[model samples]
Every structure is written in structure tokens, then in C-alpha cells.
Target: MELKQLEYFIVVCEQGSFNRAAECLYTSQPNVSKVILSLERELGRPLFERSPRGLRITPYGRTVREYARVVLRHTAIIRSMADYGWGKKFSLATYPSNMIAHLLADFYTHWQERYVVEHYEGTVEEVSGLVARGQAELGIVYVAQRQLSSFRHILSHKKLVFQPLDVKEACIYVGPHHPYYVRDSIDFSQLSSQRFIGGVHDYFAVEHHLERVSLGAISTRDLNYAMHSNSDHVIISALLHTDLCSLGLNFMHQPYSHYDIKTLRINGCEPFLTIGCIRQEGEPHSEAADWFVEQFRQLL
Candidate 1:
């Protein structure tokens, strides 16, 4: 019924013993039992079944435990906003992208007075985890259109919400020397032997676990990976100077135009990339986060 009750209930469920939960909560076992009883009376259901050996969560308790976790997480966010001064710092995490780094740099030019601006770039999964764990105030990420349903389910289970900023059709980027440079469109089958340059943490990496689930049967492993690097300069250099190619959204065409890089559509593969920002669910965005979102939206 109360936040304290829900908090204690979750600890009890995790610890599996009232005494252990009380110790974790820095309270007495009798007090923990009293609170649990009060919560059980209000809900009219036994949260846990006690035995001589230990305690086991009931069927209803399993379900309520998840809800309690979400509620406590949101409550913590609310309290953080109230007690912690926002002017002290702002943190953001994003998937490795040049445009996002540029946007953050631009934001810094205008708002550097706000001390301790933290920025992190990683793969999609890492970005989502950062925001979910409250290590970052906001996260910018992209999900393939085909993967949106599964991605949404993952975010929901993590108690995070995603807001779409823009959607762009998928494209394969290549340099002038590449054979596909003059082509208007190419199929995924044609690139089976082509070399690729991608971020170390990107789907191109062999260690990425979500590629198959996100990209369906076609994966970067099907291609001949020439190199993997985290540096944008290194990846772009390979893409421009070698026969290597990279997968990206159509929006990248303009940015790399001066380098004579081409963004060609993949034939019969209409997969779109949806760029979005994520935050902890049920928690309102702070003023700084809103401003960053606005700037990012404008950039898109």
C-alpha cells in the first residue's frame, strides 16, 4: 500500500527471508513482518508462504514484485529530481554515431555553464541499459523497423520508454572506388563477399548478440569483415579509401557528400531505422533533457 511496504516486500522477495530482508533494510525482523502483514491485509492476498526451511513467494507475489520494482524505480527518480540539483550535471548515452556526437557538441556550445556534462557512446543494448540503470538521464538509439516490436518489449520489461525522433530508410554507404559506387541499389545477396568497416560495438562485431534477432536472417557476419574499430575517423577512413562499405540510414548521404561517399538503397529490403530517445518510464524529463531532445529533433 505504501512505498515503504512495497520496498520492503521487494527486499523480502529477493532475500527470501524476513530476517535477511530486515537486516538489508537496517531494521528489525518484527518491523518487517508487521509491514508485510499490513500490506497483505490491504491486498487480501498472501504475498509469501512461510515454511520451516525458508520462504517462497506466492503466484501473486511474483506478479506484484515486478510492479513494485517499477513503482520504486519511478519513486526514486522523482525523489532524485526533487533533492538533487539538476544544474550540477547532465548525462546522456547514445549508440555510436557521428551525428549524435556533433549534436552533443553543439549543445555544449550553448549550455556549457551546466557543469559536468557526461556523454557515452556504445551499442544499442548498452545505451538502453545505461538509461534503465539510471546511469544516464537520457539515451539516443536506433532500432530497425523490423525489430521495433521486440525492442519495445525489451524496453518495457526494463521499465524504459522510447520516443521516436526520426525514421530513415536503410542504405549501404560506399566510397568512389567501390564497384557499387555508381549503383543506385543493390541486394543483400550481392554483398555476401564484400568487406565491411564498422564500430567495434556495432552489429558488425561478432560478439553482438542481438544482430540476428534485430536484423532477421541477414547479418553482418555474412559479409567479409575487413576491420572493426570504435573510432569514427578510422571507420570513415576505411569507407572512403578502401573497398569497405558500411550500413547506415539514408540521412547520412548529405554528411558524407564531400567525401564522395554514396548512400545506396538495398533492393527489396525496405528496412527502416527509427532514431529515438529513451528514459526511465513514468518519470518526467528534466529541463535539460527536454532541451537536448529539442536540439536532436531539429538536427534530424
Candidate 2:
């Protein structure tokens, strides 16, 4: 009935045991049980079924659990907004690639006068999941043309809208010492036999572009992991030293070109990926979210 009681009920249901839930909530088991029993007494129906296997929410409890989650999320949002009003603090989530290049710095500097920024970096899927769970208000990710359908499912389930920020061709690059650096472009046939240093986090973006351009038909070279790393620095370091090639946006190519690395344009291939922002659809975002989105738009 009360917010505290509802919170306790939800935690118990999630933990599946009174003792576990009590530990999680940092309270005694008897207190947790008292709250749950009081809540059931007030509702005139049992909310859970208990057995040796642990606890299971009853049909009635399941229905309440869904609404309870919404209530808790809204409450947290209200608290966040209140804190922002007292002192400008905002949280954001993005992919590793974006952060590596300081893509969001301009926005952060502009908003620093009015807000404090807390940034989180993760894989594209992980970023989407955080947004879906209300852990983050916004997310940015790069999506290959081929992975559009998979992204659509994420957007659909999360009830989020995707807005494209920029699109650029994905080019192949090798270290400065590689023989390909002397040429403006390399033939697909030449690369077919070469080992590729693909990013695990951006594999979808890489694979989708390769398939679209029929890169597989040229030669059957095995993909070799010269160095596997999610960090952009490590990936770039590996690409700068060996015959292994990497695929990335055209804009990102120029900065690395000075390191003796060069990018080759794929013939008949539109190796482009889109960078975009995602926000939950039909949900009211905080004022901070609005300001951040506007800043991103300006940068794009």
C-alpha cells in the first residue's frame, strides 16, 4: 500500500527469497516479511507463493509488479529532476568509439555552465539495453546498413526513436608500414588473401558492409586477430603496425593517415555507417535531455 511496502514487495519478488531480499535491501528478514504481510493484508490477497524452491509471484503479484516497476522508474525520474533543479547534473551513455574521439566534449563544455555530465560507454547492444531499462535517458550508436533490422527490433521493444546524426563511408586501413599505404586504393582481390583485424564490438557494422559489397567473393582469407581489443587506441595501434586492416568511418580516417596508415575505398561498395541518437518514444524526457539532444544536433 505504501511506497516503502511496494518497494519491499518488488525486491522480495525479484530476489525470490526473504533472506536474500533483506540482505539486498540492507534490512532484517523479519522487517521485510512484516512489510510484505502487511501489504497482503491490506490488499486482501496473497501476492506470492512460497516453496522450497524459493518464492514465485502469484498472478495478482505479477500484475502489480509491472505497474510497480513503472512507478519506481517515474519516482527515480522525479528525484533526478529535483536534483538537477538544485544542481545541474545529467547522465548520458554512449559507445566506446564515440567517446574515444571526444565527440561529446563540445556538448559537455557548452552544458557545463548549466549542468554536470556523467558519461557511460559500452557496446551498442549494452547501451540500448540501458536506455530500455531506464538506467540511461539517451544513447548513441553506429549502425551499419545491414543491421538496420536488428536495430529496429531494439527500438521497437524499447519504444525508442532513432535519429541519424551523420553518415560516412566505411574505409579499409592498414598500418603505416604496410605495402598498401603507397596506393590510393587497393583491389578487393588483393585484400581477399590478407588478414583482417576486425573489432568485436563493431563486428555487425563491419560484416554488414563487407557482405553488401560482395567482399567475400574476391578471396577466401581467414580473419586473423592480430590483437583483439574494444578500446579504440588498441585497435588503432594494431592497425598501425601490421598487415591487418580495419573498417571505420571516412572522417576517422584522416586523423590516422598521419601515422603512416592509409584507407582504401571499396569499389562498387557503399561502405557507410550511420551514427545516431536514441530516446524512448512517447516518454517525457528531462530538460537536460532536451538540451543535450539540441547540442548533438548542432554538432551533427
The digit string of per-residue lDDT tens for model 2 on 3-24 reads 8988998899888899999999
Task: Write down the lDDT that model 1 would get.
Answer: 0.77
Error of 2 at 226 (Å): 2.2
Task: Give me candidate 2's TM-score against the actual structure.
Answer: 0.60
Worst 10 residues of 1 by lDDT: 204-213
Candidate 1 lDDT at 215 equals 47
Off by over 4 Å in 2: 1-86, 98-100, 201-203, 214-222, 241-243, 253-262, 284-300
Residue lDDT tens for model 1, 88-191 = 67788887776776767777887877745778778888888779878788998887666678888999999998899987666678988788898988776776
Residue 171 error, candidate 1, Å: 1.0
Q: Model 1, stretches more than 4 Å misplaced?
A: 1-87, 182-184, 201-221, 253-260
Judging by TM-score against the true structure, name the best candidate: 1
Residue 216: error of model 1 in Å? 8.3
